[model samples]
Structure formats: C-alpha cells, structure tokens
Target: MTTAIDDPRRTGYAAEVVANTLLDLARAEGRQLTQMQVHKLVFIAHGFTLALLGRPLMYNTVHAWKNGPVVRRLWQHWGERGTRPIDAPLPVSAGEPDVGSDAEAMEVIRSVWNAYGGMDGVELSRLTHTRGSPWSQVYGQSADLIPNEITREYYTGLARSA
Candidate 1:
C-alpha cells in the first residue's frame, strides 16, 4: 500500500532527491548551507531544469519569499540550523529516495551546484533578488509561487548567453 499521497518520504518527485544531492555537494565543498543558500540553490536548480527539460526539478513549490526564492519545506529543515555559521548540514537522504530516472534533472542540479555553490549566501540572494527577477516581481505578495515561465525563460537566456 505505497500510495503516493500516503508516502511522506517519497512523493514520486525529485525535490528530496535533489536536496540530498545538493547537500552532498555542499558537504564536499566543506560548506554548510544557510537557509538562504539552500533555498536559492534549490530554486536555481529548478529553474535550470525547467529551462532545459520543460519541467520542474522539484515537485515542491517555489515562493518569492522576502529574501528570495524559497522552498518552504526545505526552508524549515535548513532554518533549524539557524543563522550561525558552520551550521550542521542536512542529511543526504533526508528521508527521500534518489531521483531514480531523472538523470537530466540531476545534471542541471550538478551544473547549478558547480557554478553557484562557491558563492556566499548574500551573493546568491542578491542574484535571485535582482530587479526584474521573479522574486522581485512577487516580493511581497501572498501567493508567491515563483513563476515557471519566468524561471524557464530567464535561465534559458542565461544558458544561451553563457
């Protein structure tokens, strides 16, 4: 009886899997992801994946939080680590399965990690908070779903220009 709705650990989506992968990447670099770092990186990963694959990397919602893009769920877990430097890293598994068949999404995540992982939290936040950025467009709104369209278009343009 492994119903999709009933399985809290596996939602048949790539979010947790991607989180695990990103955390592993963070660990390798001796970086402890702050809440902002976790959110921005995950959002960027989704943006690149949506740009390349026409689908979101994570099944979770991306919100234009006051700071920047945020995944509320992952935010909480990382938030618990507080604003202190060298906060404990989230577990690699974090109770979710690997992204079984979504290698393309993983590649995008890896690309994002490689390109942006070295950046500081403030820098990542600034990138996402840029004027005309999706987060800027919905900075204070309640229904802050970071638009898939904007994300795709922006990241696609970035990829092309890069």
Candidate 2:
C-alpha cells in the first residue's frame, strides 16, 4: 500500500486550510469549536483517513503538545483558546474554497464529528491521552511528531472492531 509520504498530493492541505474548514463545519452544525476541540477533531479526522483511505486527509503534521495532538498552524490561528476566522487557501487540489466538497474527505470528517462532536474539549483530550495512544507514546518529547503509522494502525484496529 502506498503511504501519504509516497503520494504526489500528500501536501495537498495546508493546516490553516483544514482548520478554517473544520471551524466552519463545526459552526454550520451549530457546534462552536474551542481550540482544543478543533485540534482533536483534526487529529481524529486524519487518523480515520489514514486508516480507511491509506492516505492523509491533510498534509499537516500532528504534534504532541501539552494537551494532545495539535496542528501548530491551527493553534496559531486560534490562539490560546479563542476560535476566530483565519484566512487560508482552500485545501482542494484545484485550490477551490470548497475543500469540504471532496466526498471522501467529508465522509471522514462528518463521521469523526458525529462520533465526537457532542463531547467537550476535555473528553476529546482524554481520548487522545490513552496510555497506548500515539500522543501517549510521545507525551514528554517536546518536539516529536506523532507518527502517522501509529495512528493508522490504531484507528484501523478500531475500525475493524467496530
């Protein structure tokens, strides 16, 4: 199986691009996202994409931060806890503003949202904080990027069992 690293469009998404879309998606669903929720959702969406599609939904790296997995670029936009609009080019390969129009991407995003959207930031944080989770494996490694392989494997197992 080809990994995102081997794909030409692996870098198709800018973190800001996904962050903006996710924030909008949350709002459209009447769920306003805090910085933490947005971060976890992105992580969850990425993991599902890797598990099911065998490709990254977005190009951004997930960082092991104090709370959980985070996209640094998204954090920069949201600040410490505030959710606000940050301009970014859409993630579509064609550079359109409708990044959510990609059916496969939307399917994963909505699936993740439905599974987690009702939860608070702290609950999502706990989910990532599980002892064997990718974030747990790198908890104190300040500069580590949570490996995609770990997330893919973990979520794949989850998908299979569910």
What TM-score do all the candidates reach, one by one?
0.79, 0.80
Pairs of residues clashing in candidate 1? none
- Which lDDT tens digits does candidate 2 get at residues 1-162? 648665434544566556667777777776566778778888888888889988777777888988889887776655665444234422333542344556777788788878887888889999989988889988797667988899898889888988
Residues 1-162 of candidate 1: C-alpha lDDT, one tens digit per residue:
668564433333545556667777888877766666777888888888777877767678888877778887787665655555544544545445566446776688888998999888899999999887778877787788877888888888877888
Q: Give the TM-score of candidate 1.
A: 0.79
lDDT, candidate 1, at 52: 80
Candidate 2 TM-score to native? 0.80
Error of 1 at 1 (Å): 14
